[model samples]
Target chain A: AQTVTQSQPEMSVQEAETVTLSCTYDTSESDYYLFWYKQPPSRQMILVIRQEAYKQQNATENRFSVNFQKAAKSFSLKISDSQLGDAAMYFCAYTRAGTASKLTFGTGTRLQVTL
Target chain B: DAMVIQNPRYQVTQFGKPVTLSCSQTLNHNVMYWYQQKSSQAPKLLFHYYDKDFNNEADTPDNFQSRRPNTSFCFLDIRSPGLGDAAMYLCATSRGQGGQETQYFGPGTRLLVL
Candidate 1:
């Protein structure tokens, strides 16, 4: 079984600044996938970024990026130029390769962006 | 744009009443998933249907049931709803069962048990 952990229950960031959300997971499989999802007040879940275990290179979206440490089993999300729209609940998820596409998610981190 | 769609954005049902939530996808994905999310908590997988095959999570209560009649439609039926079952029900779809495949989510339906 795979378990994802997000230590920070809440986080705050200033507009135009950067913030990083921490995530860790326990998985026995060598090949897997890690993902970060964002849910806003509207209750829509949006994919932020993802990283593959085999790929050492991190994944980066326009303003979102990730720091994936395979050895430590850590995958953190970095939000650059944070905007008020970035304020949402973030979740970390894990899944193994060649299995049912069920995702094990962390508790989630509530992020607040301030002006 | 092709996307996942969940009906009845908000629902109010009485305790012990049976309710069914519907989901449709235009993406023609091979997998459809149902997730339950409580306030301030992460979404938990309830069950999923791959093509026409149903897969239920180990911890998902037996009161909850799912049906995938076709490639684009899936339904979640709660036989007997309890107060604890009041939460957001999300429908998602993916292209395949690959670990890296991205799952597109619908705007979840919020169920309120009276």
Candidate 2:
């Protein structure tokens, strides 16, 4: 079974500053996928970024990026130019490559963007 | 735009009562998943449908059931609601079963058991 871990339970960042949320996973599979999702208070969860285990290069989506270290089994998300809207609970998830594969998610880190 | 839709965004049910949550997708995805998320916790996968096949997680309670009438619609049925079952029910859809396929989520239906 794959398990994702987010060591930080809560984090805070000043508006316009950068913040990095750490994530690590324990998976035996060689091929897999990693994802970061954000859920605001009373809002829907949305995808932040994704990284494939095979891809050595990190994935970047506008202000959100991922630092994926396959060998270390770590996938961290970086939010640049953080805004008030970025304040939300972030989750890290992992899944194996197969049909009907279930996603394993971390507890989550509550992000607070202070003005 | 194509999106995942969940009806009855908020639900209030009494203990032992049965409740059903509906989900529809306009993306025409091949997979639909049901997840349970408690307050301040991560979303936990309960079951999913790949095409017409139903897959349930080993740890999922039998009290919870799921049905997919077609590619565009799915339903989650709780046979007997309990206090522990009070959580946000999220419906998500994906293009395929690939590990990298992005899952689009619905707004979620918050279930409250009184």
Candidate 3:
């Protein structure tokens, strides 16, 4: 079984500043996938970024990036130039590679962006 | 654009009444999943259809069931809705290719038990 944990229940960031959300996961499988999902007030879940266990290089998408530490089993998300639109509930998920792959998600962190 | 669609964005049902949530995908993905998420909680996997095979999560209650009639359609059925069952039901789909495991989600159906 895989369990994802996000320590921060709520986070606040100034607009145009940067913020980091912490995530840690426990999984026995050597090869797996980690992901960050953003759910805004609309309650729609959107994919932010993802990282593969085998890849040491982190994943970056526009203003969103990730710091994946395979040894520590930690995967954190970083938002650069945070915008008000970035305020949302962020979730970290884990899944082992397979046909019936199911994502195990964390409790989620609520991010607030201020002007 | 091709995407996953869930019907009845907001559903209100009486307690103990059976309700079914429908999901359809135009992406033609081989896998479809149903997840239940409570307010401020993470989405929990209920079950999924990988082709015709149904995989249920161990922690998913027996009161919940799922049906995948075809490759592009899936349904989540709650036999008896309790107050505790009131939550958002999310439907997602993903194509299996090149170790693809990412799932694209729909807007979700918010079930309110009265």
Which candidate tops DockQ? 1
lDDT of 1 at B76: 94
The residue-level lDDT of candidate 1 at A93 comes to: 95
TM-score of 1: 0.97
User: By summed lDDT, which 10 consecutive residues of candidate 3 chain B come out lowest?
Assistant: B94-103
Task: Summarize candidate 3's per-residue lDDT along B1-114 as a digit string, tens digits.
Answer: 998889989999999999999999999998888999999788999988888988888889999999999998899999999999999999998886223467899999999999
Candidates in order: C-alpha RMSD to true structure = 1.1, 1.1, 1.4
**What TM-score, to 2 decimals, does candidate 3 have?**
0.95
Clashing pairs in 1: none
The better candidate by DockQ, 1 or 3, is 1
Tens-digit lDDT string for candidate 3 (A27-92) = 899988889989888666888998988999999999999999999999999999999999999999
Whole-model Cα lDDT per candidate? Answer: 0.93, 0.93, 0.90
| Every model's DockQ | 0.80, 0.74, 0.57
TM-score of each: 0.97, 0.97, 0.95
**Segments in model 2 whose C-alpha atoms lie over 4 Å from true places:** none
DockQ result, candidate 1: 0.80
Error of 1 at B57 (Å): 1.2
Residue B66 in model 2: lDDT: 95
| Regions of candidate 1 where Cα sits further than 4 Å from its true position | none
